[model samples]
Target: MSIKVFLKRVLIITMIILIIISALYIFQDKQRFTKKTGTINFSTKTEEKNILVNKNGEWENFFVKGVNLGASKPGYFPNEYGVTKEDYLRWFNLIAEMNANTIRVYTILKPEFYEALYEFNKDRENPLYIIHGMWVNDNSIEETMNAYDDRIIKNMKRDITSLIDVVHGNAYIPQNSTHASGKYKYDISQYVLGFILGIEWEGYFVYGTDLFNEEITSYDGEYLKLEEGTPFEAFLAQVGDYAVEYESEKYEEQRIIAFANWPPTDPLIQPYEPEDYNDIAQIDVDKIKGTEKFETGMFASYHIYPNYPNFLNMEPEYTEFIDDEGKNNSYRAYLKKINNHHEIPVIVTEFGVPSSRGIAHFDSTRGFDQGNLSENEQAEIIPELYEDIVKENMAGAIVFSWQDEWFKTSWNTNDLIDTERTAYWLDEQTNEQFYGLLSFDTGEEHVKSYPDGNFSEWENSKAIINDDEAKLYMDSDESYIYFKLNIKDLDLENDSVYIPIDVTPNSGAYKSSLFGLEFDRGVDFIIEIKGKENSRVYIHDYYDYLRYRAKSLPSIQKFTEERTKDMDNFNYIYQYLMENVDIYIKETKQKLIKDEQIFESGKLIYGNGNPNSDEYNSLADFFIVGDEIEIRIPWQLLNFYDPSKQKVAGDYCVEGLNPKPIRISKIYSGINVKRGEELVYSSNLQSYSWKEWNTPSYHERLKPAYYSVQKMFEDE
Candidate 1:
């Protein structure tokens, strides 16, 4: 063997060895164990399924999906049982990242709480929404009597701004005689969460069904078990008893109505309570109009808390009542009646169950169903029960929600953020935090409990949580990004206008420029903009178009009892979109482009999404598209306007997490010229990032001028 031959062979062998080693390393770290809950492969041809008002004033629905935040998160922040603005902002960011819309925010006035909120979050350029009505009883009169001189309630009325606010209430009879006069006032939510808010939300509700007033006749012919006579006579007496009892119970509710200003300018809701109907038993029919002004936009609002006993107690026979039809059937039939008679939009604003680990308001003793029923079962049951109502075509519904861990109760005794004992803590009372589509505590994926029971979780595809550690990858086919996380710790010194972060179609090309996996502060976690596109936190921004994203105002004909109830997917998206529209629109520009390269290249679909698209980009964008739009424009444009007051107001949202006001437009409104993407600018809300992002000399040396384009545009 010659020396030359041997050397050549040795070099070749070494090269092969190096190649094999490289392949092995890449395979090991490149998500070799990628496992998704598969994916929903179904597809629909129609781009939209919207609800419109038909000629007859009926809701015309072709079967489109949407969402509504139950609108009853307690309004206390930096206190017990709540999240801070940053956390709430994160949640809203997550909602948007998840691709959802709509938010059922309360329109009640709470001036005391507002002062702190206004100082921290309010601004002329930024905006806030003032919902006129309460989603439930305004501290039920009972709770009010026990709490104070009713000064708080009156002061709370200041939360309203004679705009498009709708009241939400869940009293036994949907009446508030004291505040609203002798008529029924459906504006206030239960003063203290009752069986509905306190416990699992009423699950079996259908639009227009008389949820509480179902007239039942038992086949067993067993009725009173009270007076003498046959079962028939006894049943009749029982019916009268129920009718009379219900009449009186409802009267108290009417008192609130009598006391509260109703029908906008009209003095009261039931101004003309018939002279004869006034004397009907327990109901107070004689009281004339109370406050003649509805400073809030609330006209007629009623709420029903569905689940377990609230229903059973009203009609004890319901305990064992089963029609030839199943639970969904018998239950919805009665619900339809309620909606039809009320002739107003009613939200199933509160509903939920509890796990043994926690106690939801519904059943204080509800055991460890977390022990008994599998998480899968609980998850499955939720969507079905709620979706059924959405199918009924009622106005909207919000799930009774509390933070994931401290939701039901607090577990720890010390810190506000770390506790199961806090109101946000999960307990049987809140069914241990299964209330949200995504579990905040476990961060595990669970399927919505109904028809599309096979639904899967939307992944931030680039982030792979392998074992205890997470490996993230980012990709963009278009431009470079100069991402800057506004953390105080990191040594970040790039104050250039030109984005420096490189963006490629491949996810591994770029690296993280700031913060670690777990962050402990709000100021430390903000993702600053300037690059073509950068790393995105899974935030659930739900303030933006939550109130007026009426993408599909189904015709009255389309709204049947079977057309609207507890719709999980839609509600999630709606709230998510509402919160983040401001963020999204902040960067979206009015300067239209020939091709929105990234979004289009990603092959994102913005209309009614088809589960089956041969080759495409964003699953998130495709799934939550506006029904009418095949490829969507940002919701700010679709729901409101390009960047008008109405548009910003429509997108403006504020969660109790911050308790501070939310300013949608002034903070974030601009078009990303280079990549044709949008950037949200929020330098004024509650931070000093404006100086950092803008590099204004006076920012550190002098006070920032009240309002300047430089100050405004610098945040982005």
Candidate 2:
């Protein structure tokens, strides 16, 4: 054999060895990339009293620190679902940054939401989980007076199917007026932690459904069964079974399941509570148990706000219960009771206080009222609520909302405003609209004015009444109508200022008989600044909201009449008072009285209204500095049904006490000086108008509560 031929063979062997080594390295590199970017097969299940998640091939307890994400912007309704993909992406980043491990959505959102979620979690080491929901049509249940009605049942079934399909990335729902609809191509079922079905059941609806269907007592399905339950509970069991069966058969996957419940419909018996509150209806989640086929388990989900239903405050056991801080915490007591009663893992899906200026409910013991709390106060109370839930051995807690929704209306103020146009402007006086950690503030770039007694923001504003006595400069944003009054020789201690504002073309009174004052134009509201403690807003008798409410109640129809025969009379806009009278419950055959009280609605507070001030009070209506007085009034306080369209309240007496949509192009205003019911001086009526805005200008800002919550969640 030749030496050259042997060398050639060795060279060929060396080249073959190099090729195999390079190919092996390339295969390993590809595997690494796929592990980083490929879809994760995340699995979650409920243990006896906790949620266990399969993380890095090991099952561990997953305490869900989550936030509820609503599909609404500053100028859109929830039904509209105007949230975009960019919005979802940005918000998801913020939520992850806040150390939130999960997000709970009320219903199926547009396809953009799923796409964003999939893209966001694809490459992250610790992906955020989701708890999707299926919304029920409450209008159908109320109108048909039967939960088993064909329309309601069919809609629920269809929604359940659609939710499953959307999460699996194979649904193409057509566009509809009510709910979101689009083609979903992103398979995000892996990250879905669970499914929360239905909404907060109305007590009457539950009772009526059971009464109407007396024979339908139990539900037996392939995955879930109810041995003995009410008609409503049977309905829930059937739905839960259908969801599990569909997911298992179609995709071979199973996750946790929960039905939305609250205090009014809870099964617990509270003898101290009113029969209507506790005994009228019951939704026992325990009755709906899962079968062996259902691999994942169920949990009890509730929307428990600290200050609601009056039972939380009135119950002796709850109010007297002490906490770790040695404080009487009715909220924690109620939570412990719920946790002890539930056999499954418990999750408070919705629980948080609103940082709003106006309040609808009050909590005497815990100070966690529905509203009337500052941002800092909200920041402090939320962490405490979470602590209570954790100490009670609960599974999880999700904050009520992620961002403020402008279209929300409260029970107390809903009758006075235009419900349709609520999203066009911000109403600080509405408690329900200000419940989020993210706030959408006014102005295209920055705030127009901050009623912090600073006059620099008003430099570019025009004066409506520039005269020798005073120069009144007016400005406005989506939240408030600002006024800067520069009066010569103004005296806050002795002199009183009366500002009468005409917001509508019709109604109002030419004279205020209460203050012994007359106006050049018919005015609907009057701003009387007597002193720091006595400042208040007075409304015309013909346009008062209490009269409208009185007309609706048959027992109090006589109160609807005008208090004074003279049309030119005005009265203080007192808050609508509620009193619990003795009512005999036919079922229990016992008479009971609930709690009630009155509040001064129109009273104005004097302090710094700027967000930058340490003493900032969101309820501050006016602040005085030297001879210049800066006043910022909420549009709703002036009886503006919809200020975006320049709409205000009309004469209820003539408009038949119903909502009369009245629009005005301009508002007339004037100022005058008085001393002890005597008019010292007056100015001519000045007209101010602004252009109607279809799309409101706003910027997103994270509230201080977000940081506090972030810290607490990170620590967890």
Candidate 3:
């Protein structure tokens, strides 16, 4: 062969080798990219006593570090599901940013939620896991008084099937008024940690079901069965079996399963508990045995709050128990009991304190009351609660909520306000509405006015009382009706300020003998400011809610007088309380009489309401500056039943105690100043009217609690 021909052949061979090496390099790079950005196929299962997640081809013990995501915003109910895709995306980012690995949602939400979750996790290295829930029809259970009622069972089964399909992302649910409906194309089953089966069962419903269906003691199913269990337990077993069977058979997938329960309906007997909170019916999850086909296994779920049922306070074991920190921690003691009782992994689905002004329940030992806690205090207590859960050797702890819900109502204040209009406004006084780490303030960007002694926000506001002595500016948002009074010569020590507000036309007083002043319009509520520490709100006797409640109860008729149409003197608003008292007549006859007591509930606190301030207090009612005073009053405190529709309270006597809704376009308010005994200055009645809004304006803000929780989760 010639030298040139041999050289050409060598060059060709070298070019072929280079092309092959480059092709191999390109293929390996493509594989690496796909592995980096591909869907993470994770599997979660319960081991002997812990929840283990197999991600990245290795199983590791997983602590949830989760938050409960509710489906309501500021202006909608949970059933309405007013959250949008953008909202879900933003919130998911926030949750992830907060270092929360999981989010547990109760009930199937709109398709946007799944879509957002899928899109968010598409390219993420570590994605947020989900614990999807299926809510039971509470109304049906109450109406039928049986958990195994035909209608209830059928509906529950249908919901189970629907939720299974939703997680697998192959279901098309039709439009419905109550539940979320749409084409669910996002297959997020891989990221789902587990399923929580039902809502917190009412004690009475469980009792009734067990009592009536005593014959139906055990349920046998393909995947799960109940032996020597109550009728309600059988129903739960059936539900769990159906969930396991459908998910396994239809999609060839199995994950962790749990039934939702709470402290009130726990199987344990609290002898010192109230009759209502006592174990009305036992739902023993231990009786429900899983078959070999149920590979993932089952766990126990509960919604436990620290302060409730009164048993935690009264029970000797919990009260005297000491925690790892060597403190008498009742919460940790209760959690230890629960953990010791359950053989399977236990998860506290709901646990957290609320940053609310009005307190519903008290915890004397730990001070983790239901409400009346500042944001910082709430933040501090959440991590402490989580620590207790972790120290108890439980599966995980999911906080009660991620954001504050406006539609929630508490037992103490629900009757005083209209339930229909709860979504339209923010009620800081309602404990249920303030249980979230995120808050929705009453403005598009920030609060309209912060009672932080800063008068800059009041510059654009119109002055209602522009007199020689004082100028009063009034403004309102979804949260509060704000008032700024600039007195020419202000004295927090000597002079007393009285502001009489007329919210309703039916019942009020023109003359308040208590304040020694009269108003042009019938004043239903009065604000008396003696000093920074001695300021409070008072209601006219005819319009007092506590008085109305007392008068409405037939047994307490002797303690309360008949409601008259006549305008009465203003009095401090009181909280009605009833207690059993022993009475003896002439030392011969003994009787147990239910006596009523009064507690002052209208006392106001003064602090900086500004969110930016280091001394910010969410419960701050008023602030006094050098020569100015800023006051914020919740709409419910003034007996405005539905401020969204401008509806106030009507005459309760004529309306049979349940006050009729009275609509008013404007509120008439007047201010007066008193020095010693003589009235120094008085202003004419000023009418403040605003356009009614069915949709409220609000902005999402992460409370300080979010960072506190984030730090705890990150450390873990």
User: Who wins the TM-score comparison?
Assistant: 3
After superposing candidate 1 on the true structure, give the runs of residues whose Cα lies further than 4 Å from its correct spot.
1-85, 97-100, 106-153, 159-305, 313-330, 354-373, 402-434, 442-716
Candidate 3 per-residue lDDT, tens place, 598-641, comes to 23457788999888998988788899988799999888778778
Candidate 2 residue lDDT tens string, 173-196? 998644689888799998999999
Better of 1 and 3 by TM-score: 3
What's the number of clashes in each of the models?
Answer: 178, 0, 0
Regions of model 2 farther than 4 Å from truth: 1-42, 275-279, 548-565, 569-596, 675-680
- Deviation (Å) of 117 in candidate 1: 14
- Expressed as tens digits, the lDDT of each residue in 537-593 for candidate 1 is 111122222122323322222323332221111211111111001111112332221
Indicate the worst ten consecutive residues by lDDT in candidate 2.
Answer: 33-42
Give lDDT: candidate 2, residue 90: 96
- lDDT assessment of candidate 1: 0.24
Cα distance off (Å), candidate 2, residue 353: 1.0
TM-score of 2: 0.89
Error of 1 at 341 (Å): 2.6
Report lDDT (CA) for all predictions: 0.24, 0.82, 0.82
